[model samples]
Target: MIKKRTRIVCVTLICSLLLPIQSASVKAADNNGSELSEEISSLADFEAVDELIEQRVDAMTDGDMSEYHELTEELEAHGCEDVSAQEVQELTGETSQGLLNSQIQSRNNISVQTKGLYSAAASNVTFSKSITNVSYGGKSYKVMKITASPKGRGTLFNTGSVTQKYNSSIKAGSLNLLKIVAKKAGSASNVIKLVSLYDTVCSVIRGFKSTTKVEGVEANYTWTVEEICSFIYVYDARVKNYRISASYNKAKYVVSMNLPYLKVKNGKSYSGITHKQYSDWISAQNYGKTDKAISCFKQGTTYNSWVYNVSMTGCKGKNIKNVYLQHPESAMTLGYWN
Candidate 1:
């Protein structure tokens, strides 16, 4: 029989010795850096959490899942929290809700609860000693709980539309889109089946502009557009190779996967309105006359065999109409409104 405390200490010591280099392979700049060669996002936070996991085998009853929930609670006690898939799911798990000034429409579709997102805000550990039974291989080992000091991780699990990618994957909210990016980098079979997993629900919140017009005269609509889109790209930059590498500014790959809201101001709608192939009418209720500004949901159109979301809403603001637009693979790609 092994002394639980003794075995845990020995393993920790050995692992510590094996990983001699405690720092990151490449020293990344602060996450706030605006230049291409700067900012590595939340790797540091993840790394810290990882290190804690390595040390605190006792607290990982259910592995990262357990630790994530427990640690988030502790972090909240310190006025900070880590936002991940789990967090997003917990905070906005219901049909739809508002969170942190933004409307979390659903799973991956976050309706804008706040305007300026590409923005800021998560932390801490208390020093304590306790030996708990940590299970491994269906057996229990006694280990000490090791907690991280939040002071060291002066980082936040934030939201916004900044280009945040890691190891060739673009991440937004809880979405990690490496395979989709890889496809653009020129690979035949996609590692990602984004086309399979998600049913992208694209909506519009048009106030200033009109959505895609149908082939006929004028179709009044109130419906949701659902599409299965694979990634086709558009970029603000003129890069010959969209593939991210050390040669390119990784920070410049700001492909936001967050659900986008097409904001238009009253009388300041987009100069052009797109034409859609089909429009599904879910609501037969089109009030006869000038009553009030309400919700609009238009169907979608197909381009290159892929569907794009289109919308129409009753809001008078040519700028902001509440209509749902197109579906993406839920992967982010830049496109011109045209």
Candidate 2:
């Protein structure tokens, strides 16, 4: 009986110890579950914050000013006190306010017009000119103007006028014209004249020289024009006579000479003269068919240049003087041909 009693007491003590251990395991499991739930909630909160930020960025990009402002305010209200206009710009690349400001500024400063028409007449030929203001990429430009004058003596005697406004960018080499009708004396019939003009921009010529060997003879050419801009005036006198003249500004010398009249099948056409005819005339002037150089004075410093070998014609002879190089339809004007 004593053995049985001892056995029962030992079993009861084991049961009591086991109860606390089991209870502790159950409590640990519950704690682990609570931590897991909190982590999941944090992840969800982070996702919500990311989504809000994306929405705000979209609003700014879409130019939804109202929504953009609202989203910014919401971010500040939601514990993002540092949220600011600049911060939004950083996130969205641009702000609605900035775009609006630019639009307003552009609208206010928009001014476009044809400055005026200027003409110089000599030998029954009239060259009418005008400049148009063009806006592009938030900047304004004064582009060259080309207008057609009338044909024959009547149109030459009358005033040539041109007035135009352009909104698009004017590219180099683009042609524009002014149309006129020539009324002959004692005749009721009138002829239509189409005058063509080209645009060229002059570049500063630093230092350039070249030498070539032709038929075992060495021909050397050098440049002497600097810091000047050149403009071209090509006048079409019907189909029989086409003249090319140049004007220079910010220059020390003047250009005074009309190129030899080019005979064109259609004088009204832009490129009136055939290439062969034009080259032949230049070659006959004793100018080498290699390179043409123009020399001029600017600010006490002589500038020499040969813009392009447009036509392989350079001044000849050892004492090459009074030579002018010009890039037809180009800004590179070399000599004074008045």
Q: Write the per-residue lDDT of candidate 2 for residues 1-338, one digit (tens) a residue.
A: 24633543455456446432121000001211221111111001112222333344344334686875675465433222222222222222223333444434554742321011111211222122222222334643222211121112221112121122222223212322222222222344232322221211111111211111111111222212211222322212231111222322211111111112211122211211111111010111211111111111112222222221111112121122232222212121111011
How far does residue 165 in candidate 1 sit from its true spot (Å)? Answer: 36
Give the Å error, residue 319, model 2.
9.6
Model 2 poorest 10 in a row by lDDT: 35-44
TM-score of 1: 0.18
Cα lDDT, model 1, residue 90: 22
The whole-model lDDT of each prediction reads: 0.22, 0.24
After superposition of all CA atoms, the RMSD between model 2 and the true structure is 36.6
Q: For residues 254-328, what per-residue lDDT tens digits would candidate 1 score against the true structure?
A: 111332121122222221132222222121111110011100000112122221212222112111122232221
Highest-TM-score candidate:
1
Model 1 residue 278 CA deviation (Å) reads: 30
